[model samples]
Target: MLSAEEIHEIEAEAQHYPTREAVLIDALRIVQSHRGWVSDDALRDLAEFLHMTEADLDGVASFYNLIYRKPVGRHVIHLCDSISCWIEGYAGVRRALAARLGVDFGETTKDGRFTFLPIVCLGCCDRAPAMLVDGELHVHLTPDNIAGALEKYA
Candidate 1:
């Protein structure tokens, strides 16, 4: 069941849209903000609250990369893999992060501190080889500075 606070927030967001279904993405974000990730049960409850089908809600959730369906670590790392990032040495950064965190893309650290994932682009082509740690953009990254960049999160 959606909490009172969650419902209240969702309702407030719904007012900005023409229909409840239009608030689907915001609803998912609101729930995820409170719960960390959206589970099957939560999706079902949210769908019901929005008068939508589970399949519909799940489709939106799956299509959006930011909407985590499974449990994630305390911090999520999104590394850009666009052509610009690749040209700017994304491979080295990926290797450094994997070696440092001991987890590949789509995997979370054993201690559940970080989850690493690849994004198509962060839209900062000029500052390639960038990553977002818990939504904070870190641009102009190199293999050497990854440790320092990650240190501030924990």
Candidate 2:
């Protein structure tokens, strides 16, 4: 069941849209903000609350990579795999992250510290190799700096 606070926030955001369906993303975000990730039950509750079909809401949630449909670690690492990043040695960084975290893309560390995933871009082409760790953008990454960048998270 959706918490009273979650319902209140969703309702507040709903006022800005013409229909509840229009606020689907925001409603999902509200639920995720409180729960970290959207579970199947929460998805169903949200779909019903917004008068949307579960399939429709699920499609939207899955389409948006930021909306995690399953459990995630405390931190999410979104490594950019754009051509610019690739040119700047994204491979080495990926290797370093995988080695250090012991998890590949789309997988979370066993310690529940970080979930690593690849992103199409981070919009820092000039910086080349870049990543967003727990929403903080890290640019000009090299294999050597991965540890320093992640040390603060724990």
Candidate 3:
């Protein structure tokens, strides 16, 4: 499942650990890099590699939003529907994003290029209606701005 180069990199990183278990995070990252997300089979392989139980490794992956347990679209657009963003004007932003992506929240585009998810906050309360695209935050969102900015990604 891994190439010689990837195995070399993985082993190099694993070597730094006093215990192979210490490499769980790095292993998960490598797996994600190769597969774009962590599948059950991948996590099991990761568990075996780390000398840990699947549940143990899975707990860590599931706790972090950065790790994708399920298949996701190519681009993940997390729109902040937090109280602050809502008070400002998140509805319009949400609508714009949904329309631009041609999929509703928690859905992948038919072409599998984009997905929409709602986030509680981006910690940019001052910039309400803020949203994140591929982990990059954008502030002061409007329908026009959101639609215009998403053209290239679409």
Candidate 4:
């Protein structure tokens, strides 16, 4: 069930938009900020509040990469898979993370410390081979520095 606080926050955000649908993304974000990820129940409740169908809201959630449908670990690591990142040693970074965390993309660590996922880009081609750990971008990564970079989050 959506909390009265969650509903109130969503309604408050909706006030800035012309329509409820316009607030859909922010509504999902609001829920995610509080709950970590948007579950099926939360999605349905949010959809009903916004007068949108569950399927419709689910579509919106699935379309956005940042909106995690399943539960994620405490930290989410978004490895860039863009052309620049791939060119600039993305393989080593991927391997390092897979080895260090013992989890592949879309999987969470056994200790529930981190979740690995691939992102198309972080808009930092200049700083290629980059990744975001809990929304903090780390750039210019190499195999050698990758472990140290992750340590900050650990």
Residue 18, model 1: Cα distance from true site in angstroms: 2.0
Our model 2 lands, by Cα RMSD against the true structure, at 1.0
Error of 2 at 136 (Å): 0.7
TM-score of each: 0.96, 0.95, 0.81, 0.93
lDDT by residue for model 4 (70-142), tens: 9999899999999999999999889988998999999999988999999998899998989999899999998
The residue-level lDDT of candidate 3 at 152 comes to 64
Candidate order by decreasing TM-score: 1, 2, 4, 3
The list of candidate 1 runs beyond 4 A from truth reads none
Ranking of models by lDDT: 1, 2, 4, 3
Best by TM-score: 1
lDDT of 1 by residue, 1-154 (tens): 9999999999998999887799999999999999999999999999899889999999999999899999999999999999999999999999999999999999999999999999989999999899999899999999999999999887
Per candidate, the number of residue pairs that clash is 0, 0, 0, 0
Q: Candidate 2: misplaced stretches above 4 Å?
A: none
Model 3 — which ten-residue stretch has the worst lDDT?
1-10
The best candidate in terms of lDDT: 1
Clashing pairs in 1: none
Give the least accurate 10-residue stretch of model 4, judged by summed lDDT.
Answer: 145-154
In model 4, residue pairs whose N, Cα or C atoms come closer than 3 Å (at least 3 residues apart or on different chains), thus clashing, are none
- Answer with 1 or 2, whichever has the higher lDDT: 1
Better of 1 and 4 by TM-score: 1
> Relative to the true structure, how large is the alpha-carbon lDDT of every model?
0.95, 0.93, 0.81, 0.91
